[model samples]
Target chain A: MDLFIQLTLTGLTNGAILAMAALGFVLIFKASDVINFAQGEFLLIGAYVTFAMLAQLGLHWTLGLLLTLGVAVALGVAVERLVLRPMIGEPIISVIMVTIGLSSLLKALVSAIWGNQPKAFPPFIPSQPVKILGATVGEDRLWAIVIAIFMLGIFSVFFRRSREGIAMRAVADDQQAALSMGISVKKIFAWAWSIAAATAAIGGALVANIVGVGPELAGFGLRVFPVVILGGLDSIPGAIIGGVVIGLLEAYTGGYIGQGLNQVLPFIVLILILMIRPYGLFGQEIIERV
Target chain B: MLTLNNIEVIYNEVILVLKGMSLQVPEGKIVGLLGSNGAGKSTTLKAISGLLKPEDGEVTDGSIKFMGEAIHHKDAAEIVRMGIFQVMEGRRVFEHLTAEENLLAGGYTRRERDLSSDLEMVYSYFPRLKERRHQTAGYLSGGEQQMLAIGRALMAQPRLMLLDEPSLGLAPMLVLEIFGIIKRINQEQGTTILLVEQNANLTLGVADYAYIMENGRIVLEGYPEDLRQNADVREFYLGLTEVGQRKSYRDVKHYKRRKRWLS
Candidate 1:
């Protein structure tokens, strides 16, 4: 029972991180139909920005976090305008390739400035351990989980209740109809990209605290793809559930099944789920005619 | 209040979907566009709404003036902002949003005003939509989605409304109900409409002016009464038996009169 508890808690912690990242990924995809390959780079860039604000500028962690999210949003908008906007009417493959290229370009650029080395992340939450149900947990992990859930909750409200959110959803459903209804799809696209970037930034910074900040922070973007697919690409709840499931699977595999299996489980599950339910768990199924 | 003058749309520089299709919707009038399949009725609507670019022809070949100003080259978004909206052929409501949200999207351009009264008005036109306001639009039946689509457009407070086949995929009773609402909208709101329909009976019943399109061109044009009386239109559309039989105008007129009495 203790082992199960330990595994569950540990999995919940990791799931929280994946959930945050996957939320951003799904937001962009749901609103714009663009599979953003550069999402991981946004996370990595955000972490490095927070590092720069803290270490170089001597700013408080709180200020650095806010600055990081803001910069990340700006970066997202820039990328949408410079890369995604021009490729709007292009072939889907072309759009996907452009994002892939953008991610690589961002990686190279970040490495050039940050020197491709892992850096220590200072604890945003105090270095205190909290004992819950006879299991000890770090304050940062608790903070990370709390913040992740809060952010996701806030986003859920924004997507459900806000005018811009509804407008963004309209654009996603039918661009032409959206335009007819006086919804600016371009503006919605920018908002989706910016919001996704902001979420990624926070998720990256949180993950950096859990595992030391590094260029590999961006790699979480790729890891999120499977989670999103499992959840249902367009379904917000699916993203959260998919993230938690993947996180638990990873935790169990690392704890008992083996670390190698941990890496392979998500991919295997992703393929199987896609074959069975192409739309993801909560996603609307699409029927295509030849 | 709307005009499409010499609008030419070519697909890939080869397939001419619309060739010099000119049309007009006078202020506060419902203009019905009738056509067989592949007759470019929908394409003309698309061109007017700025969903397609006319590279092979010119809107300036004459001039497409809306409210006395040429709006031919304006973008779709800009055109919508100028109080022109389309209820597309399929009633493309946002599947994920509730009927109310779909209506809210119509008032996307109207940010400051309270939308409740407008909502109330839309409900008056489509009571079923009011009942299903909280339900996702995708779950609505075909007739309900049509009401939602029209309700959404009404929320935009358009000066000119373009309805593309409002009666498509509907039962005859629902068709009458939709046409009734459309007539009410024109009579009550005085919103000018350009209606594109495959159902000639419904079109003739609702429109003041009518245009008959064939092979990407307007083949016949007249007032609804004139169109109802035209021999060519009667022969082609009113109904013709394909057997080796010849019919005179008098016989066709008598048949139409009898049918009208029965209807």
Candidate 2:
């Protein structure tokens, strides 16, 4: 029972972080129909930039977090303006290829600046153990869960209730129709890119807070694919649930079944989902009434 | 309020769609532009609304002036902000969004933060939309989606509303219902409308003045009463032949194309 409790808490923490990362992926995909391959690189940049501020520059962690987010937003806007904007009206496959190129470029830039070694992250969220529900959990892990849920909640509300959020969704549904309504597709694309970056940065920061920042941190982003696939690609709630499910599965497999199989478990689920439910558990069915 | 002066549109630098299409829409009145398929009716509205840019269509010559300003250079959002909203053909509502959210999106350019009054105004115009407000717009019936599209236009509170075939793909009765509301929207809000449609009979019924076009140019223009009495309109558009009319198949083919008017 104690082992189960410990595994569940750890799983929830990882799931929350996965949810944060997938949130941005869904946003960009929903708004622009671009499958951003660089989303993982975004995580690397976020982790490295924050590490630079907190460790090398000796800035306070809060200020470091803010500056990292600012950098993320700028990165997002610049990418959309410079790379994606010109590709408008191009074949969707070509547009997707551009994103793959972008991921490579960003990854190269990060290593060029930060080097190939992992750096110990500044102790922002203390890793001191905490007791919760009769199970011991790392303090950073608990905070990660809290911060992830908070970020996800704010965005869920934003998309559901805010005017601009609704406009963004409208563009996702139909670009020409949204334009006719005076919703600028260009502006919405910019917003999607920027916000997606900000969320991924937060997710990156959370993961860094737990594990030290490194070039290998990008590998953490690859794990997000299973979450996004399990969740509907465009559904925010789906991302949240999928994150938790994948996280719990990973924790259980590692805790009980074995060590190596845990890492491979998400891919197995991804294959099962693709074969059984291509749209994901909560994805839109792509059916149009008229 | 809106005037297009000999505007020629070329798509992909070739495939000329609109050849010197010219028309004028006066303030506070309904102006109907009647044309068959491929006569550049939809393209004309796209030119006025600046939706042409997206489709690689350009207004290469002449100018479009709205409210006495040269607007040919402006884009769609700028034109919309200047108080001209277009209800695009085929009722292109955001399928995933709820009906109410689609309307809120139309209010994107409005200066005021509070939109309850505008939403209420739209609901008053189309009560059916308010009932289906929470329903996903894609799942709505064809007629209901058309209403939502028109309601979206109204949410913008546009001064000059350009409607492209509001009656397309609906029952005759629903078309009549939509036309009645359109006339009401114009009269009540003093919103000038440039209506482009192939339904000449219904358009002529609602329009104060009308223009008939063929091959991307206006072939006839007059008050509805005058256009209704025109022999060409009666024979071709209204399908009304005179008593003891002896029109042959050749005449029928000629009436369909009506190339004599181009001269």
Candidate 3:
């Protein structure tokens, strides 16, 4: 029971961070139908930029975070304008290929600037051990869970009630129809990219605090695919639930089943889900009448 | 309020869809543009509303003027901000969005206005939409989706509303209901309308003036009453054999008869 509690708490913290990264991936997919291969790179870039602001420059944590987000926004807009916009009307496979190429480019840029060696992340949140439900965990882990949940809740409301959010969904539904209604499809794409980058950066920074900043952090993007596929690629709530579910499963498997099995289990489950419920638990299936 | 002056539209720079198509939609009037399928009626509306560029279609020659400003080069969003909205064919309501959200999306161009009142106004026109406002639009019945599409257009509060094939697929009764509401919208709001349709009888019933297009050009145009008296219109559209001539039990398809203007 003690082991179970420990595993569950740790799983929750990891899941929360996974949910944050997956949320950004889902956002880009929902708004632009582009399965972003560079999603992991966004997280990597975010961590390094925040590291530079906080550790190298020794800026205030708040200032560093804000500056990091600003950089993210600019990066997103520039990428949209320079890289993705020109590729509009190109084949879906070609667009996907470009994103794959983009992932490599972003990874290279990070290594060029920050080097390949791992760096210790600047301390922002306290890592003091705290007890919840008889399970001891770090204060930072608790904070991660709280912050991730809060951000997810805010995004859910934004997509539902906000005008900009509705516009984005409208564009997703039918670009031509949305254009007819005067929604700037281009602007929506920029917004999607920016928000996706900003959220991924936050997730990256949190993960950096836990594991330290390194190129390996980019691997979180690969881990997110199963989460998104399990949840639903176009679903925000799916990301959260999928994150926690996968997180818990991984923890339980690692604790009980043995080494390296946890990494392989999620993919096995992902394949099963794909074969059964292809749209995932909460994915919207396009219903067309004959 | 809208004028297409000998506009030439080419798709992918080769396939010419609209060849010098000229038409005018005066303010506060419903002008019916009647055409058969592939007659460029939709393209003309697209050209006027600047929706062609997205389809790799371009206005290679001529000009489209809206409110006395040449707007052929402007993008769809910019043209919409200047108060022109197109209710496209197939009632392309956002399938995943609720009916109310679809309506809110229409009011996207104008920022500083009460959308709730606009929603109320749309509900008044389409009470059915109000009932189904919370329902996802993709699941709505065809007639209901049609109403939602029109209600969405109302939310935009556009001055020149370009309606493309409003009667595409619907029950006769529902089509009549929709047309009645459309006429009411035109009269009450005093908004200029360019209505493109294949249904000549119903279009003539609602239009103040009408144009008949074929193969990307206006073949003939006149007041609906005048066109009704034309022999070609009588035989082809109304299925009249001749004045006091014997009528056959079989209603011959209009396509079987050659268009006098086209020939």
Candidate 4:
């Protein structure tokens, strides 16, 4: 029972990290109908930037985190304008290929600059452990969970209340109509990319504090796919729920069930969900014309 | 006032859709362009709305002069801003937006200062839309979606309205109601209208002047009363010839287009 409890808490912490990365993917997909394969690279870049700020520049951890997010947001905007915009209305396969190619490029660039070594990220939270319901968890882990939940909440409000958010939703529904209504579809695409990049940066930073930062940070971007698929690609609430469910499953399986199911559990869930409801839990089912 | 002179449009450089189609709608009159499925009625409207550029079609060969200016060169959104609004055949309302949001988007070209009044006027036209203003457009019934599309177009405050098959997919009652509203808009707002319809019965009933198009060419043109009285038009075109042979107005375009063959 103690082992189960410990595993569950740890799983939840990891799930929170997955949710953060998934949020960025959802934003870009929703606004531009572009699957950003480079989303993972954004996370990796963000963590390195944060590490450099804190360790090399001697900035405070909190300040470093903020600066890292700002940089990520800028990177997102630059990518939209430079990479995504030129490929507008291109074949979906071509667009997907572009993003995958971009991911490879970013991974190579990161390795060239930072080398293939892991670095410690100083935790913004105090270096202490907390006991919760007889299970011990690190303060940084708890902070990761809390911060992830908070960011998701903030994003929900942005989607529900902000005019720009509604405009983005409108564009997602019908790009031509949205453009006809004078909503600059290009601007919405840029904003979506920026927000997604910013979220990935924060996710990267949080993961670095919990685990050592490395090129492997890019893996989290791909890891988010299961959560996003489970949650529904377009659903914000689904992302949170999907994240928690996957987290708990991973924890329980690793601790009790054992074997390899834990490693492939998310993929299994994603496949099942997709087969049953191709749009996932919250995805809008579209009827194609031809 | 709007005019389309010899606007030719080919879909893929091979499929000739609109072949030298020309039309004119005088200020504040309801003109009807009647045609069958492949006759290019919708394509003609699309050409005027700037959705498709003619590779082999040019306004100079036949020009589109709107309010005495060449508007064929203008963009669709620009033409919309110039007060030409199209209620596309399928009632393509933004499906995800609430009814009111759809209406708000319609007024995209309006000044921010004039939006509130425009909103009120649209509500006055379709009070049902006001009641369901918060409901997403997808949930609206077929008839309601058509109403919302028209109301949205009205929000643009167009001087000339291009209505493409407002009766399509609608029940008989809704079709009649729609035609009634079209007449009311013309009578009350004094807006000129170029209506395209595959339903010839409805077009002839509502139009001040009617043009019968077949194979992307205008085969007949006249006042509604004159077209109704024509013997050959009534028989072969209007589906009225089966009733009986009656003395009717003479065919003009048939005579004109076949001048060389006749002479």
Candidate 5:
């Protein structure tokens, strides 16, 4: 019972972080129909920038987080304006290739600036463990889960009630229809990028606190891909549910099945989901009739 | 008032579609643009509404002035802000949105205006839209979709509404019903309208003035009654033959080959 409770708490923490990362991926894909392969790089940059502010400059944790988010938003907007804007009408394959190329470029840039070695992430959250349902878990992991859920709740309300949020949904529904209704499709695209960056930054910072900052942080992007695919690329709620399911699967498999099995389980689930239900659990089935 | 002067349009910088087409739509009048398929009627509407640029098409020459100011360089959103809205061909509603939300989207440019009243006003015009206000627009029948499309446009409080092929693919009774509502919208709102259609009989019935276009240029222009009385227009557009004429196919082909409009 203790082992099961411990694994469940750990799974929840990891799932929360994965949900945050997948939220960014889903937002970009939903709004612009671009599979942003550079999403992981956004998280890497966020983690490193936050680490630099806190560890190197000895800034307060709150100030470091704010600065990291600011930089993330600016980076997102700049990337959209400079790289993605010109590729708007290009073929889908070319756009995907551009994003793939962007991911490599970002990884190389981060390595050049910070060096290839891993740097210790200074402890911002307290190191004490919290007892939950008779199972002790790291306080930072508990905090991360709370923060991720909080952000998800905020985004759900924003997408549901906010005027700009509805406009974004309208654009996703039909670009020409949105444009005809006087909604600026360009503005919505920029908003989507910025929002994705901001969420990824929070996820990155939290993950860096768990594991030391390094180029390996970019691997989180690859890991989150399966989560988003499992959830439904365009469904926000699906991201959360998929994240938790994958997290639990990993925790159980890693606990009992063997070493390295947790890492491989998500992809297996992804392939199975793709074959059985291509749209994911909650994705809207796109029906196109001639 | 809107005026197009010797405007020329080309697709992909080649293949000229509109060749020196010029027309004037006076304020507070419903002007019909009548043409057969491939005659550039829809292209003209697109040029006026500034939707041509996105399709790899551009108005290559001349100027379009809306309310006596040159608006040829403005984008679609900018033109919409200037109080001209186009109901695109084929009823392009946001299929995923409810009818009410679709109407709200029409008021996107005019965010400061009270939308609830406009929603009520739209419902008043098309009561069917009111009944299906909560239903997703994709599920609505063809005629209801057309009403929703027009109602969505009216929510913008447009000074000029450009409707393209409003009667296309609809049954005759539904076409008349929609046309009746179109006329009522113009009369009640005093909104100037530029209506494009291939349904000459119905268009002429409601239009205050009519322009007949062929091969991207205006071939004839007059009041509806004048066009209705003309023997050529009656025979070709209205499908009415001269008394006991029974013209042979050869004669009809010869007449088309050497049309007076071509001269």
Candidate 6:
């Protein structure tokens, strides 16, 4: 029972991080229909920028986090304007390939600046373990879970009440209709990219505090593909639920069954879900009758 | 007031759709544009509202002036912000959004105005929309969707409303009901209107002035009563041929060959 509790906590923590990353993916896909292969690099950039601020520049953790988010927003806007704008009206496959190229470019740029070595993130949170219901959990993990949930709540409210958020949903529903309603589709696309980058940066910063910051940090993007797919690519709540489910599955399987099963389990579940429900658990099913 | 002078629209820079088309819509009047399919009625509306550019269509040789300002070069959002709204054909509501949310989105440009009053006004005009305010737009019946589309446009507080085929695919009773409401909106709000429709008799009944378009040109223009009295218009558009005389196919073909308007 103790072992089960410990594994569940660990799973929930990891799931929260994955949910944060998957939220970014879902936002970009919903607004612009781009798969955003460079999403993981946004996380890496966030982690490294935060690391530089906190460790090398000697800034406080709060200030470093804020600066990292600002940088992420700037990067996101620049990418949309410089790289993606010209590719509008291009084939979907070409646009997707462009994102894949962008991902490789970002990775190479990060490596060129920081080198390929992993660096320890400064301990922003204390290393002490907290006891919860007779099971011990790391303090940083608990903080991560709380922060992730808070960000998700903020996003939900924004979509429901804010004018810009509602406009984004309108664009996602129908671009031509949105334009007719005086909503600028181009502006919405830029904002979506910016918000997605900001969220990915925050997710990266959180994950970096756990695993040491390195090139491998970008691999979190690849791991999150299954989460978004399972949740429904366009649904925000689906991202959280899918993340938690995948996280728990990994924890339980890897804890009791075998050593390497966690790494392969998410893909297996992804395939199963795809076969059963191609639109995803919460995705809007497209109905067309001839 | 709206005016189009010698406008020519071309698709793909080659296929000419509207050739030197021109028309005038007086302020605070309902003007009807009657045409068969592919006669460029919708294209003319799109040109005035700046929607032609999206479909790779462009006004190559004309100018559109809205309230004395040249507006052919403006963006769609800019045109909409300037108070010209097109309730597009096929009732293009945001399917995922609720009916009320759809109205709120239409009021997007009028963010500074009191949206609640405007929303209330729309609800009053189309009570069916208010009843289905929380339902997704896609699930609404065809007649309800049309009401929602017009109500959505009304939320814009438009000076000039361009309605394209409001009667399309609707039953005759529903069409009469919708058109009755449209006439009320024009009379009550004093909103200028350019109504495009294939149902010529219905449109002419509500219009103070009417234009008949064929092959992208205005072939005839008059008051509704005058057009209804003209023998050619009565036969071709009003579907009344020679007072109970059943015209043979040969007579119809001959009439087309010798169409007075074409000549």
Query: Candidate 5 — which pairs collide?
Result: none
Report the C-alpha lDDT of model 2 over A12-56, residue by residue, as the tens digit.
Answer: 999998888888899999998888888888988888888888989
lDDT of 1 by residue, B1-263 (tens): 78777776776566877778888888999999999899998878777777664234333334567888887778778888888998888889898888999998888887555789999999999999989999988888989999999999999889899999999989999999999999999989999999999888779988999999988888888998888787667756666444467777666564455322112
Q: A210, model 6: CA deviation in Å?
A: 1.5
TM-score of the second chain for every model: 0.87, 0.95, 0.94, 0.87, 0.95, 0.96
Interface RMSD, in order shown: 3.2, 0.9, 0.7, 4.0, 1.9, 1.7
lDDT of 5 by residue, A186-285 (tens): 8888999999999999999998998879999999899887898888988899888888889889998998887699999999999999999888997767
Give the per-residue lDDT digits (tens) of candidate 4, residues B1-263.
78878876666567777667888898989999987788888777777766554234433346777888887777666778778888877887777678887887777667664477877887887888888989988888888999998898888889988898999898999899889888998998888899999777778898999887878777778998887887656644576644655535663344444422112
Which parts of model 1 have CA positions greater than 4 angstroms off?
A1-3, A287-290, B13-15, B53-62, B240-263
Q: Model 1: which docking level applies? A: acceptable
Q: Assess every candidate by TM-score.
A: 0.90, 0.97, 0.97, 0.82, 0.95, 0.97
Q: After superposing candidate 6, which stretches have Cα over 4 Å from the reference?
A: A288-290, B254-256
DockQ-better candidate, 1 vs 2: 2
Give the alpha carbon lDDT tens digit for every residue of B53-157 in model 2. Answer: 899999999999998999988989999999999999999888889989988999999988999999999999999988999998889999999999999999899
**Judged by DockQ relative to the true structure, which candidate is superior, 2 or 4?**
2
DockQ of 1: 0.44
TM-score of chain A of 6: 0.97
**Pairs of residues clashing in candidate 4:** B235-B241
Candidate number with the higher TM-score (4 or 5): 5
Q: B140 in model 4: Cα distance from truth in Å?
A: 3.5
Q: What DockQ does predicted model 2 obtain?
A: 0.82
lDDT string, candidate 1, A1-290, tens digits: 66677778888888888888888888988888878888888888877887788777888988888888889889888988998888776776888788899889989999999888898877676747777887777777777678777876887888787778888888888887887777777789889999888888888877777776888788788789889999999878787888889989998888887779998999999999989998888897652212
